[model samples]
Target: MSSNVAGRVVCYSVLSPPRRSRREQIISQLLTSVGSLREHNRTVRVVVFWLGSRHQETEDRLRSLEAQVVHLGSYEDLLHPFPGGDVLVRYPVLHKYFVLDAVLEDLGTSQLLLIDCDTVFLDDVDKLFERHADVDLAACAEVGTVRRERGYDPAYLDEEHLARLAQSLGGRFVEPINSGILLLSRKGIEELAKLRPALLEITLRLMVGLAKSAEESDFAPLVQLRERLASGAPEVKGVAPLGFPSSNHWIVEEVALWLALGLTESLTMRDLPPSDAALGGEVYRRPRSASSWIIGHYFSVDTAPAMSWCRTGQPPHASPKGRSRAADELPIDPALAASPLLVEHEGFALYEDLFGLDVLSEMTREAREAYWGGQEQSLTARFGGVGRDSHPPRRLVSAGGGDVQDAAYCSPSLKAFLESLCGLEVEPTGRRGSVNYYTRSGDFMGLHLDVVQCELVVLTVLQDLSPADDPSGSWELFPGQVGRPLPSVSTGRRDRRSIKAMPGQSLVMFGGLVPHRVRPVAAGQRRIVSALCFRAGQTALEPPTVPQD
Candidate 1:
């Protein structure tokens, strides 16, 4: 099928039945995303599925952008109680059903793109359709436990109870999926009809019975509690039979539902067009083409700012010229610094051999199957790299009241590394919550100084370092400038001194002074570990140096 068959893409966010401020912010972000689409002369319909009385000004704003604005009124009149009108109204599940109903009834087009308003589209996403064939739904992988991780044992679920629940709901176990970015084709809409009533019932049980709060866990029930509530309904029980493969562990159960329902077999990115051709922009084509894309997810209110890139050299050490060291060794001890406490260094040159000379010139390719491997139960033991900042400031803490730096479902090695870097001595300011990990073809973070309050910037590159002639997986940093605009130098002109960080090695840079970014890894191999550490202080503290070059 031609790429244009992707049809006019419409992105929307269903705002709360309450909270005008949140609704406004969501509308603003939607508008901003639509504005980018407008600039490209694309027919991108933007809508806000709101609750309260519609505002003309808001509608006017969307109209000015030449995008559609929709406000889905409360359905209380259609059904007596409006099922979950109060507690579960803000959840996206019902809104999804409402939209699905419209689409199936031919009120809308063949393809629909639903996005969480919290996300900002750095570029056009129209290409998602071209690659989608045979798949009813297209979505990013939900990071979750594999069968191996789950230990193939039926005991994981109380079999008797699970059987009873499965019989009632018509499924066995529940898998997870991130509903943030959902791509539904016409086939998906039809399939959704088969599962709609059961799914709605499950969603309501989750919202009212299990989750109760706006924030919910995967296991929440939906059926209303009478004199005493029952354990679960048949639809909830049926989810287990799906047996979906868990890719992104963040929303494993949701993905499980998709797979259990036999929807997983219908999707693929193989046929999707390149983002550039679909979005129709210069910036989308070049991975490092834009500063905003380089600083992925910056200014997001959810998590602390992290320098999420890699380098190809060794850890920072005291230079013999600066202090009094040998010809070959880099300093790891923090006490050796002569300037105040934390000394700043910029560019990749200062970080020589960080990856080890031998490791820097090699390829360590893991099996592709193994590379994509993940687990759940064993997650707590393996990749935990370090402990996080103790005495975490209120802003950076999770709703769980734990440190925000903790990537909840990560391996133990990651946790250990986090613990080592984000000790009680160093606490990150503006630490909001755990960060979502993301990557793509030739994907990487570009050079920029971090605005967050952290002492050391640590990255563990996921891929092995290739030869100098093939530096596909090395780290690069821009020198002299801290959070400065892209220099007016000619295209392809780059500063020579920045270091290349290799896999397994870590670089602890004075984040404030060192303006740095990662070079995109086109193909070959590359991996990275990022941890932002801050200096200890009684109150919010700033680095003594200004961010200007």
Candidate 2:
């Protein structure tokens, strides 16, 4: 039953050594599912990559069902020299990534459909192939409902994980891609093959770093064993920086695939519609529609019983355990808890006390001295304007001291914390030169949205006088239109919300989205604030501004 024929869709499934009984049961169901594809008029072939010692009975069973089975030699060769070999060995599910490229090479098929063993076909997969014919890859997007049901939370990822994602995906994260069902064209397969070596090295380094950090755990012995095996291997180098382990080992494949696709030029990715019926482990029935459900994924809560029924030819038993609550109960790291609290509202988020009081106090003193020493300059003429008419002058002084920059923009913790809150990785715009604003009595900034240079603006209040001293000088936020000129500060618009930032408080706002201004200061008051700018992801440059009406 060699199905290595070209111009046909080869459906590939990898089965590593599982319990003998369970493996047989899954293969039986998988063969039946593959057989059903023929009735749907699909020109398809089924091939199973078995990673274990050759079992004649298993090979005979698959052949009887008209499916080809190839026994992959000792899996140890795939794991030996990699830096994170131990971790991979511990979690064998990750083996898919190491062997998938080789499987594709062996099959030599221009079109490949990779599915989990538990998945069943309810409809013709011909449409799926046609839909992705012009694209490099097509995969289902892991929806929020499915992720929550599966107990996966993106927020649980820490700074190092976020950094890896940023380096790999050009963003903090892309919509999670399910690895259970992947449709790859020849280009996509070749791309993965080309990037496999570098990707494996990086993945191993990250895993080794994580293992080294957990030296006292029960897992430490496994790492040591792997280290001994890798001692003579040239690929075994010093540990890389540590990052958090993914919720499941299979996530390694998803990450590697994403990175490979991202780095591969001339290849595009498209989302397979949820309606295409890629059901999860929830045991959802085939949807009643004009077309049948395309694929059913049995990797979730109900997989074992479904497999048991196929094995003994008996009704499936109720799942012994329901969905896992571990993900919900997972502890929030102390570092995350200690990060600044972001209170969100329409159009903005207010981060209370982002900087310590002592730091702000010292910075305030420096800014006041700069103003008094005549180092301040007028910023109104350059940045604040409504077409040709510039607003009244406001005093602007540099952060001047490196300490302020370190506290505000250069702190890794601060950057990570902000990224967590925003759910987007941000970087300094490199347009550094932050400034401290000093507004004396009678000074007021006009109502205008900030320029589109930065994705977000961080404002630290160094000194805010008491309401009694300066009730009129609070930052007045206008909610209605963006980019359009609003009525003057004295217009007393009922929609405006006045925000008073006390000393040490920080305000983080989507600069290009919210239009705001400074209220006129009272005679005895002086308002001082430090402002910094950041751009989200690498592509967020100076966006087009809203049209001025």
Q: Rate the local accuracy (lDDT) of all candidates.
A: 0.37, 0.52
Candidate 2 ranges beyond 4 A from true positions: 1-6, 13-15, 18-29, 35-43, 81-87, 94-108, 143-152, 155-164, 168-174, 213-237, 282-291, 305-549
Stretches of candidate 1 exceeding 4 Å from the true structure: 1-7, 39-41, 53-57, 75-93, 105-108, 145-168, 171-176, 205-451, 454-549
TM-score of model 1 vs. true structure: 0.44
lDDT per residue, candidate 1, 1-549, as tens digits?
112233545556453423333344456555555665555446545555554467777778878886665565654432235433443332323455555554455544577666555343444444444445346665432222232231332322223432344445555443323355567777766666566555544444433323233221212122232212235544233332322122122233343244245322333322222231211111121223322331012121321111111111111111223543221322222321322323333311123333443432231221111122211111111111011111111111011111212332133453354334333233343232121111222434443344334444444343443554555544555444322333321224464344555544556555544444455444333342334344433222444221110
For candidate 2, what is the TM-score?
A: 0.47
Which 10-residue window in model 1 sums to the lowest lDDT?
A: 389-398
Query: After aligning candidate 2 to the native by TM-score, how far in Å is the CA of 439 from where it should be?
Result: 56
In model 1, how large is the Cα lDDT of residue 421?
A: 37
lDDT of the structure predicted as candidate 2: 0.52
